[model samples]
Target: MLATVARPSPESDPFSPPGIALEASALMGLRHLARRGTGATTRGRSGLPGGLVTRRRGRGTEPDDVRPWAEGDDVRHIDRNATARTGTLHVRTHHEERDRAVVLLADFRPSMLFGTRRALRSVAAAEALVLLGWRIAGDGGRVGLCVAGAEPLALPPRGAGRGMAALCQGLARGHAGALAAPLHDDPPLSPILEQARALLPAGGHLVLASALDSPGDDFSERLAALAERISVSLILVSDAFERIAPPGLYPYATPDGRRGTARISGRARPAPEDRLAACARLGLACLRLDTETGPEGFAPLMERLDAVL
Candidate 1:
């Protein structure tokens, strides 16, 4: 069974920087994609079988709660009798909103260790979790996470706080010990992806985070199959620095503790661009993360995605 992992409280997170400013910037860039005069139900394209939930508007009700009106306000829900007795205008405020279930898949293979950045891609994946989860959680949504590698770690869907914590713990672990060993030879990612599919409460969203480092074509096909089942967003985290490293030139240590450098031309892998293009072809919303750029560049990326999702 998938479980939630413990994480430091918001108070203890040293990097718990205020998200409001950053979120506001992302929202600003996303405003163009916003629909104003249209009815609440008409927001964004509908997805999947259930269609979508619509919002009802009234006088005093704000999409994001601005303020209360004194008098002469739209009395869509006013009590005429009460107004006569109280001699004051009264209005009800309603928030027109909907929630999206977001699934986060993190790839924690050993290859993530090869990064020019000190924190490594493994650590960088955790940071991406916070950024992506922040937006979804801000809108009162749920999040599920899956860690892929020789051993896959799964954290079933949970509300914001617990889900984020669980993801962090999953990323911190090197690999699954016992429960994941049995599936090593032919580990089918289908079960986990199906779990993700089940968690998306009709009309929800999905986000898969990975380095695309695993062997074979299983993960790719699994992801394509997932998109057909549900709306998915892919955040592909990769280390560009690794592509430039010369082969055989890596430092190698012998079993006896002796260390030497070998000239290996095949050590380096193909460019991340190819993998990213493949994801785009799969019709998944792709977010390319790099250590050099950090999460600050997420503003524009989310802007483009806001329209699609």
Candidate 2:
């Protein structure tokens, strides 16, 4: 069962940082940065289905080559200017765009509500969705969003301008819902992933953003199976406090006005390490983003995604 909590206070709290929230308008600032990559979507091409790292390029189309007419060639391809100049039949080749279907899977669970920096983990995930989600839409690729948590929601893929608008609005709606959602037990991600799969085609890509706080034991196995059909990318959202907290006793308050004390030390948690290791072993394109990370951090990641785009 899911309980409903009131909106978090704007004041500072030990577990919940002050002024940490999601704003759809603020995500547009990411647009200028990752201009190259188109979210998580696979280009139509040939490669190993088991998570192939491939950059799909137009087939024999670049440089507008003028080649001698071959047997069974289409008449529409004939280059009249070249044919007249060379006194022989020639064909003109043109470049074409590769199409991809992009979708983002966002995890907004109990753990995502905590942050010791600029914003909550859920907010960061929302930002990532806006960043790549818009890029995909701008590139003429269909964009879809699936929010996973106590109240899961799926927005089917839509193309171009309207698709981009829906994605942004959906982020705002989903983030607000996550804020009010109670701390239900961490749910298995398999069901949400299965739902996302149904929305995409064979070569589609699924971009997942999460803190990996409570991914089930079969998470890695499930990813391996999914790789056999579609491309996958991961965005690891985290906070500096999660890695090492300054030594001190911090006062915290819950949304229900309950108060408590949390002792903090500099020891790091092992969960992030294990999750990162699994991603590495699977050869997934993974990017780490902390609450303090700025747009400059996305340059390299954008380049890689751009190639895949």
Clash counts for all predictions:
5, 0
Error of 1 at 244 (Å): 2.6
lDDT values of the candidates?
0.52, 0.67
Model 2: ten consecutive residues of lowest lDDT? 44-53
* 49-98: candidate 1 lDDT, tens digit per residue: 11123344443234333234466666565556556667775445555445
Best candidate per TM-score, number? Answer: 2
The segments of candidate 1 whose C-alpha lies over 4 angstroms from its true place after superposition are 1-99, 149-151, 173-191, 246-248, 253-262, 266-269, 295-308
TM-score for each model: 0.58, 0.76
RMSD of each: 11.6, 5.8
